[model samples]
Target chain A: MRGVVLHGPGDVRVEDRADPRIVQPTDAIIRVTAACVCGSDLWPYRGVDKSDEPAPMGHEYVGVVEQVGDQVKTIKAGDFVVGSFFASDNTCEICQAGYQSRCVHAELIGAIGTQAQYARIPLADGTLVATPGPPDAGLVPSLLTASDVLGTGWFGAVAAEAGPGKTVAVVGDGAVGLLGVLAARQLGAERIVVFSRHADRQELATEFGATDILTERGDQGVTQLKELTGGLGAHSVIEAVGTQQSMMQAIRSTRPGGHVGYVGVAHGVALPGEELFFSGVHLHGGPAPVRRFLPELIGLIWDRTIDPGKVFDLELPLEEAAEGYRAMDERRAIKTLLRP
Target chain B: MRGVVLHGPGDVRVEDRADPRIVQPTDAIIRVTAACVCGSDLWPYRGVDKSDEPAPMGHEYVGVVEQVGDQVKTIKAGDFVVGSFFASDNTCEICQAGYQSRCVHAELIGAIGTQAQYARIPLADGTLVATPGPPDAGLVPSLLTASDVLGTGWFGAVAAEAGPGKTVAVVGDGAVGLLGVLAARQLGAERIVVFSRHADRQELATEFGATDILTERGDQGVTQLKELTGGLGAHSVIEAVGTQQSMMQAIRSTRPGGHVGYVGVAHGVALPGEELFFSGVHLHGGPAPVRRFLPELIGLIWDRTIDPGKVFDLELPLEEAAEGYRAMDERRAIKTLLRP
Candidate 1:
């Protein structure tokens, strides 16, 4: 089987590898139907996250179960499914509390590589959500998103307490942020504001239910957001970029007693404690409990309530995974979907 | 009238001043029965928060209403009442959401000097909670505490979601943290842990229902808390110290999905964005919405269901307030009660 591998910075390849087989009773072998390059994947590829060894790529996937181990009961062979970046034994105490990413016996599915023709998924019963049926070919990209990006965006909105009468503001215009606009809209937010500078991204944001768009960053962006919300700031602010500037802007964009739901993978960022304390905003985020929202996300995509796949601007065959990575790295595509 | 005033660091005076009277249509005149030197007062007294000009001191008070304005209906003359540090209109959208401290028309009553013999309380109807009658002499101190410390502690417990078999940890051993133990107990927590090094405070903490007392500070304190909670950390952690170390300790002492309710008036603290993001803890706090809890707290104290006055270890006449401030600043007293 062929799978994507990163040898070094700027070096990606689709190489032949051993076909995956269930090595544990709790594992199942899945035939990958769709996969995508993630913004997080860029961290390693750009050498920002130093790594010397060859690393397996991809953590997002929509696949069909080809074989199941003896212990797999809920998921069966030939079932269409969507699973998260991290595999959790959904029965654990942490998973029960809806923080499956931190489940006691969790495993990063990215370690095993989902961008392959065949891959072994551990804790199959807990990680995979079976669909009503094989989804229409047109829905593949959206279903694939439920595995990570869309689920992450959904988690951000929920964490921010976005719902009826809420003025929700979104930071970052990436795939996740754009989808956050959609999530906030679906949650019945009275108004949705998105921050972005690119015309392309802004268009996608507006299409995703944004009621207002600001092409500003940092303090100016916060000022514009405050101006839009009658100077009280938004009732809920979604932060999808993990930088000091983005984080501060997100906090400043929220009103007192409001919520800042941040899904950005923070890097080298330090928040002024005094400011955050005085801001009076509730802060909640992290490696998003994407698994917690996968089921609902899957249902929405199946019923066509949302088309999160609009985030994908380029599509490629599995063999051209390198081009997919390049396009995303150069900002030529918001996201690239790869078919195996 | 006479009130406690700060001349400078290490300089305090009980000075004569004009008596207060109804100044606004919603104002009420109260004869202060009990006023106390607050930990925050020490900020300006010790020059930690410097001010050159003389400023009236104290914010917590329980007193008898001597007169009411035409608009004051819920509170009448001759009523005994407990009110918070801030006076809130309690009818704005922010107040309706229970963050009365951030009400659009909120005013910090400290500016009027609750430590004075006579105080003109504005927005009396919304800022004050009437007791069933004049509280017994013994309940005076506890009811006075309800005006600030006890109410603040209660807010911390509620924000931490400490209830029903959950393990609650408190970071700080001051009057607020000590009372937080009582709040956790009242909230039905199975275990209450308080961080304290002072033998006297440790004793007070135990009496207030702290099941564990950690003498260590900083990283060691976090380790001890996790060790006591089966290595998963406490389910709810309250931060009563506003410093960066205390905030981080509170966050680290809680489990992945746990809540950290911080009430410390954060000064010069900066939280590492990366660490906080990955911690997966929900953070909520600022100035405690003490006004929101006044009525309930007043009820608990009036019925003798809880005793919060034990936090004050020293008492002095309003004329000797300088001595009270010195005692608290020198660590000879956990809290000081000033009589008028």
Candidate 2:
């Protein structure tokens, strides 16, 4: 099987690797139809998150099930499905409470590297949701996003309590942020504001239901968000960037008693306890329980109710996996899709 | 008039000061019937929170309305009332959203020194909640607790979503933390766990409905809490201590998808964002919006449903204000009641 591997910082390669086998009775092997580079992947690519050895690359994918372990009752071979980046038993207390990403017996699918011709999925019945049938080729990218980004963005919106009568502000212009704007709109938010400095991203954000766009960052962006909401700040804020500045901005741009839902993979951010305490905002977010929302999101995608696939601006063949990483890292692509 | 003043760290004195008068058209002057030393007072008394001048001390009080400015509508002279430490014009959006402490025109009543013979309360109509009538002398301490500690603890419980079938854990054994246990019980929590090192405080916590008592402090405390909750952690955690250890303990003790409500006045706490993010817990708290819960708390106190006054283990005349401070500072008293 051909798969993507990271040899070191900024060193991505597509090479032949041994095929994955069913290691557990709850596992299933899937022939990946498509895979994509994610914002989190850039963490190690930029050497911000270190690795001791060569590590497998992607976590998001859309694929057709090729084989299933004996104990995997709900999933079977030849079924087209999407699974969360984290494989959870879904029946654990945490997963039942809607925190599958933190399930007691969770596994990061990234370790299996979905950016390959075939991948093994654990907790098959709990992690993967099969579509009604094979999705249209045109809907593959959108279905792929439901594996992570779309579900993550939706979780951010829900955590922020974005709904009718809410003025939601999103901080970040990445695929997750843009999709968060769409999620907020779909959740019935009265107004959506997104902070973006790029023309292309801003336009996409606007199209995804952002009623207001600020080309500023940090304090200035918070000021504008507050000004737009009558000096009270937005009712909900979605922080899709994990930088210290972005976290603080998200916290500051929310009105007292509002909520902040942050989904960005935090690095060196240290929140000032005093400011957070005084902010009087509810803070809730982490690795999203993407598994929890997979079914509904797949339904939405199947019916063409949302167009999250538009986030993938660059597409490449599996052999050009390095180019896919380069484009996303250099901001040339909002997200990149690679056909396997 | 006489008032308690902090000349510097460890230097508390009872001194002659000018009596408070109505300063705003919406203000009311009150003859303080009872004032109590608070855990927050120890911050400055211990020199952890520095000040440039001999600041008047005290914010929690139950009093009789002495006079009202022309525009003061809800409160009248001769009426007995209990008000929050932060005066807010409750009509503002933030206040209406139940975050009166962060109202656009908030005024910290502590600045006017409720520990004095007379204190001026701004936003009288919004901040002061009148009792059914003048209460018996025995109820004074309890009503005073409502002005701060009781209301703060209740807010913590409410913010943590303490209710039926929920396992609630309280971190901190101060008056507020003890009251939080009471609040959780009243809110129908299935089980209550309190972390306390002192025998006296632990006994009080048990009386306040604590079902489990852990004398451990930091990591050990969290471990015991997890062990008690089947290793999943408590469903709701009330954090009433603002130090780094207590904050981290509170966060670590809550299960993923659980809630942490913190109300202690933060001093020098900085939350590690990455840890908080991956913790997958909902965090909501700050200077509690005591005014929002004042009416309910006062009613409970009046009906004898809760005896928060028991927390005031020491009583001192106005002239012995320094001794009252010393007793609370040295942990000789859980709280001290001062009569002017």
Candidate 3:
């Protein structure tokens, strides 16, 4: 089976790899139907994070189960499925508390690589959610999004406590940030503001229910958001950029007693406890428990209630995986989908 | 009127000052019946905080209303009242959201010096909570405790979400931290663990309802707490010390999905964003909205349901304000009450 591997920085290549087989009694062999390059993939691609060897490249996928081990019960062979980036044993105390990312028996699918023809998914019954049937071609990107971004965005909105009559401010314009606007809207937020400088991303933000867009950064961004909310700042803030500046902006953009749901993969950031204490905002975030939201997100996508698939700007055959990585790393595409 | 003033580091003096008069339409002049030195007062007394000149000291007090401004309606002259350290209008949007500490018309009573024989309280109608009648002489200490420490401790417990069947870990041995144990017990917490090494403070903590006492500090304290909670950490952590180490211990001691309510006045602490983000715990704290809990705390005191007055270990006339400061500064007394 051919899969994507990164031997070193700026060295993504397609190579023939051993086909994955069910190992654990709870594992399932998934034949990749579609997968995509995630924003987080750029961490190593840009040389910001080091790679020791030829490591697996992808975690997001919409696949069809080709085989299942003896213990797998909820899913069967030939079932079309969407699974989270992290495989969790959903029955753990942590998973029962809706934090599957912190599940006692959790595994990162990225470690095994999903950008391949076949992959073994551990804890199949807990990690994978099946689609109603063979999904239509148009639903592929949306279902694949349920594997990570959509569920992540939904988690951000929920963490921010965005709901009826609340004003939500989003700090990034990436696919997850854009989808967060949609999630906040669906959660009944009356005012949605997206911080973005790009014209194209701003338009998509507006389309996704951002009531306003601020083309400012840091303090100026906080000022603009506060001015729009009667100088009290937004009631909820979703931080999708994990930089120190973005985190501070998100914290400052929220009013006292507000909530900040930050889902960005943190990089080189430290939050000042004094500032947060004075801000009087409730803060909670981490690698989102996407598995917790997968069922709902998959239901919403299958019913065509939300169009998260719009985030994908480029699509190609699995053989052209390098181009997909290049396009995203160079910011030429918001996301890329690869058909196997 | 005689007041407590800090001329310089270790230079507390009892000096005659001008009698306070109503300065705002919502202000009231109070004849202080009792006042006390706070843990935060030690900051400047020990020279950790700079003071260019003699500065007014003390913010916690219970007093008799001597005069009321025209706009004051809820409180009147001759009313015995227990007011929060920070006076808030309590009708603003922030106050309505239960964060009266950030009220638009909030005033720090310490600035005006509640340690004086006569003091002016701003936003009197919103700041002062009247007792059913004149408090008994024996209840004076409890009422004074409500003015700051007890209220702050209660806020910490509530912020940490201490409740039935929850395990609560308190991370300070100060008056507020000790009272937090009492508050957690009152709130129905099943297990209360207090981190204290001082024999006196630990004894008081146990008396207040601490089910366990961990004498360790820092990482070791967290390890002990985790070991006590089946290796998952406590369900709620109350941070009563405003230092980086205490804050981190409070954060580390809590399980994922737990809450941390910190009430200590933050001095110079910064939290690492990446660690906090990955910790997966809810964080909320600041200058507590003591006014929001005053009525309940007062009722608890009135009914003899809790005896928070035990925190006061020394009593002195207002004229011996210098000795009171010295006693607290030397750790010779847990707290010193001044009678004016």
Best by DockQ: 2
DockQ score of the complex predicted as candidate 2: 0.91
lDDT agreement of model 3 with the native: 0.92
lDDT of 3 by residue, A1-340 (tens): 9999988878889889999988899999999999999888888888877877789889999899999999999999999999999999999877888888878788999999998898999999999999999999999999999898888889999999999999999999988999999999999999999999988889989998999999999999999998898889999999997889999999999999899999998888977777888898988888889999998898899899999999999998888988998998877888899887
List pairs with backbone clashes in candidate 1: A273-B269, A273-B270
Q: What Cα-based lDDT does every candidate model obtain?
A: 0.91, 0.94, 0.92
State the C-alpha RMSD over the true interface residues for candidate 3, after superposing those residues.
1.1
- What DockQ results for candidate 3? 0.76
- The full ranking of all candidates by TM-score, starting with the best, is 2, 3, 1
Over B41-151, each residue of candidate 2 has an lDDT whose tens digit, in order, gives: 999999999999999999998889989999988899999999999999999999999999999999997887888898999999999999999999888889999999999
Poorest stretch of ten by lDDT in candidate 1 chain A: A271-280
For residue A78, give model 3's deviation from the true position in Å: 2.0
Model 2 TM-score on a 0 to 1 scale:
0.99
Question: lDDT ranking from best to worst?
Answer: 2, 3, 1
Please give the distance, in angstroms, between residue A6's alpha carbon in candidate 2 and its true position after superposition: 0.4
Stretches off by above 4 angstroms in model 3 are none
- Candidate 2 chain A least-lDDT 10 residues: A220-229
Error of 1 at B225 (Å): 2.2
**Best-fitting candidate, scored by lDDT:** 2
Compute the lDDT for candidate 2.
0.94
